[model samples]
Target: MLSDDELLRYSRQILLKQVDIEGQLKLKGSRVLIVGLGGLGSPVALYLAAAGVGELHLADFDSVDLTNLQRQVLHDSTSVGAQKVDSAIARLSALNPLARLVPHRTAMDVDSLDAAVAAVDLVLDCTDNFSVREAVNAACVAAKKPLVSGAAIRLEGQLSVFDSRVETSPCYHCLYGHGSEAELTCSEAGVLGPVVGMLGSLQALEALKLLAGFGEPLIGRLLLVDALSSRFRELRVKRDPGCAVCGNHNG
Candidate 1:
C-alpha cells in the first residue's frame, strides 16, 4: 500500500500503462545494489531513488576529487574529498527521502560482495575496472540475481543485462572470460561527461523494467553507443557453455 505521499510522488509513473499502481508498488518494495558511485553510479542512484526503489545499497571506496565533478553529478564542490558513497547518499537522500540509502564506504571483499549480492533483489555494476566488474558478476551469478552492467569510455558506451535467474541468460563472465582485461580509466581514456550519464540512465531504466516486470529487459543482448557519431547498435550475446562462473563444469 502506498502512502499518500508515495502515491503523489510516483503518480506519473503509476499512470503509465506499463507501470500502473501495481508496478509502482513493486518498485517501492524492491532493493538494489549499486556497486560504484562515480559517473555511472551518479545517474543510476538518482534515477532509482526517484523511481521509488525501496532500498539502495551503494558501494564505493574512492573519495571525490575535483576531476569527478565533470561527470559525477551526485556530488558538488562541497563533496570534494568526501567518500563517494557518502557524497552520493547525501544527494540521493535529498532527492527522495522516502528511499532508504545504505552506503558502503570500503571496497567490498569477496565475502562482503557475495553477502551484498545475495541480500539484494538486483544489482547495477557501475564500476569502471574489470576486476570489480568480474567480482560483482561472480557474486550475482552465485546468487542467481539479475545484473545490469554498463560502461562508458571516451565517447563510446555499452550496456548489457545478465540475469542468472533465467536459465538461458548469460552471466557477465560468459560474455567476457574470467581472465583479466586491460583496465581503462576515464582519466586515461578521457570520457565525455554525458556519455557515462547516458549509460547510467539506461541502466536505471533497465533496472526499473526488471523490477516492475514491464517491457523487455536487455538480456543476452548488448547495446552499444557511439556518442561521437550519436549512433547506437545492438550485438547479440550468448552464454558460453564452458563459462567457469555459470557453466556446467563445477570443481
Candidate 2:
C-alpha cells in the first residue's frame, strides 16, 4: 500500500489512465538489474529511479572518468574519481529516495552475474562491451528473465528486448552471436552525448512498459537510431533455433 506521500509523489504518472494506482503499485513492486553505469546506463538509471521502480541493482566495476562527463549524466565533476555505482547511488538517491539502490561495485564473474539475474525481476543491458552483453544475455536466459538491451556508438544506437520466458522472443545471443571483434567503444569511436542519452531513455520507457504490464515491448524487434540523419528504423528479429543460449528452450 502506498503512503500518502507516495501517492502524491507519483500523482502525475498515476494520472495517466494507462498507469493508474494499480500500475504505480506494479512499478513499486518491481526489481531491476542495470548492468553498466556509463553513457547508456546513466539515463536508464535516472529515469527508472524517477519513475519509482522499487529496487535497482546497479552493477559497474569502473570508476567515473573525466571523459565520462561528456555523456554519462549521472556523474558530475565531483564524481570524477568516484566509483560509478557509488556515484549512481548518490545521484539516484537524490532523485528519488523511495527507490532502493543496490550496488554491485566489483566486477561480476559468471556465477555472480547469474545470481544477480536470478534475483532481479528484470535486467537491462546498458554496457558497451559486446562480450559483457553476451554474458548478460546468457545469464538472463538461464534465469528466464526479460532483458532490455541498448547500445550506442558513433552517433548510432540500437535497442531491443529479449525475454527467454516467451518462446517467440529471441535472446540477445540469437540476435548477435559472437559479435564483431572490431566493435569500438565510445572513447575510441566517439559518440554524440544525446545519442546514448536517447537510447537510454527509450530503454527506460521499454522497462516501465514491461514492468507495469502496459504497452508492447520490443521483443523480437530491433530499433535502429541514426542520429546523424535523425531517422529511426526497426527490423523484425526471429528466434534462432540453433541459438546456443536460448535455442534449447525454444520450440
Q: Per-residue lDDT tens digits of candidate 1, residues 67-169?
A: 9999999999999999998888789888999999887889889999999999889999998889889999889988889999999999999999999877778
Per-residue lDDT for 1-251 in model 2, tens only?
Answer: 99998999899999999899999999999999999999989999999999889999999999999999999999999999999999999999999999988999998999999999999999999998888889999999988999999999998999999998899999988889898968888889899999999999999999999999999999989999999999999999999999998999877
User: Over the full model, what C-alpha lDDT does candidate 1 score relative to the true structure?
Assistant: 0.92
lDDT (CA) per prediction: 0.92, 0.94
TM-score of 2: 0.99
Query: Can you give the lDDT of residue 236 in candidate 2?
Result: 100
- TM-score of every candidate: 0.97, 0.99
Which ranges in model 2 have alpha carbons more than 4 Å from their true place? none
How well does candidate 2 score on lDDT at residue 160?
97
Highest lDDT among the candidates is held by which one? 2
Residue-pair clashes per candidate: 0, 0
Model 2: ten consecutive residues of lowest lDDT: 178-187
Clashing pairs in 1: none
In lDDT terms, how accurate is model 2? Answer: 0.94
